[model samples]
Target: MSTRPILALISGANRGIGLAIATGLARQGAHVLVGCRDLSKGETACKALRAEGLQVRPVELDTTSTASVTRLAERIQQSYGYLDSLVNNAGIGVDDDPTLTTADRLQRTMSVNVLGPILLTDAMVPLLEASGRGRIVNVSSELASFGLRADPDWAFADFAMPIYQASKAALNSLTLSYARQLRDKGIKVNSICPGYTATEATNYAGNRTPDQAAVVAIRYALLNGDGPTGTFANDHGELPW
Candidate 1:
């Protein structure tokens, strides 16, 4: 009804899956806000997107920083007054090695992966509520699937990154909680795994490309009034919680 185009904010969108999602949404006529902690990188991404005649702008955001998160909320509220979509694409995963116990490593990992998205989503709820219909897509991992991990024969059952896995599980739970909280308000929130994409996080070991992985997130983000919420799914279908 607003005719302002679908306004979307994607964090950590400078590169990888985040950038791909931004591009996909923009190509579909959404005015995207590329949220990046590194302003230069954000600008670089936006420049490329702009060249493609896509509607997108770079916004300074660092999910781990309370000030940055709060500032982004304020900026969006003041600028657009409503946010139609939000993609919590900014996340970090560290090696599960003997160096994990350091105070710095533990706190930083959790702060980026878990606490950051939680705070960012909480801060942006008002903007999301302003939209008649809002969609929230949390970029979670299939690795967080407890149902799959419990099975000895699951493909990734042998893989282990305890802290990262736990953080994503927590993320999936929060996505459901937020979905329920905002259900009546018409804000759909869902957890989506981009599959094992070849990004910097995986050191390019993954078989899937960022563009290939962006499909499901784009689908979830652009769902209409009757789409499902509180779901954990991927390109395939609903994943076991």
Candidate 2:
């Protein structure tokens, strides 16, 4: 086994599903980096985990900003030298308005959900490669799956937010691209839908708790070198594209 301590960065980790994912990794002995747009909230989140005696720290990161994403990579490179895992858990849901224009919604959703992860991963992949056993977990959603959406009987059929859904589909595509490109370097990249979990994003209305939603994502992060890559899955198993 690699002797180097595992270092994992989870973006938007100040609360909700991101916090849950970060907490789960910390519990497993990974040095968790909580990435948040808000400094105070990030610190607060990390402090809570630290109180639990988990190796956790806060890193200010606005995934949509190039400068911010660059700073994140610089800080990690300077502090830990390399990254073992990167969970792109930062996302937004602003396309729910019935009157929202498609272009406007797509621009906003893609900025954080699609473009941000792409840039961050591109910048961080070198560090992950240095670890020799790298993992990139993209926090996607079932709404992104075209197959599921095509079914009129699908449970979430009524929840139509095209921008957010399309953004995740783009994210899933990026996951596969990264998995293929980094396969020879021993990096695993996969997208996962945590299901409809109760979090600030969902106003905590869903039946699933954040911890429950984070389970599969944590599992993917801890995968061995031999584990499958380029997969889109959830708690149960593989999901339709």
Number of the top TM-score candidate: 1
lDDT for residue 229 in candidate 2, whole number 0-100: 98
Q: List the residue pairs that clash in candidate 1.
A: none
Each prediction's number of clashing residue pairs: 0, 0
Candidate 2, residues 1-241, lDDT tens digits: the string is 5675689999999999999999999999899899999989988888878889999899999988989999989988998788999999999988875676867778888999999999889889989998888999999999999888889999988887777888899999999899999999899999999998888888888899999999999999989867899999999999988
Per-residue lDDT of model 1, residues 1-241, tens digit only:
5567899999899999999999999999999999998999999889978998999999999998899999989989888899999999999887454666656566777898889888889998888889888899999999999999989999999998777888899999999899999998889999999999899888899999999999999999999987999999999899999
Model 2 residue 150 CA deviation in Å: 2.7
Collision pairs in model 2 = none
Top-scoring candidate (lDDT): 1
Name the 10 consecutive residues with the lowest summed lDDT in model 2: 96-105
In angstroms, the error of model 1 at 54 is 0.6
lDDT of each: 0.91, 0.91
Q: Which stretches of candidate 1 lie over 4 Å from their true place?
A: 97-103
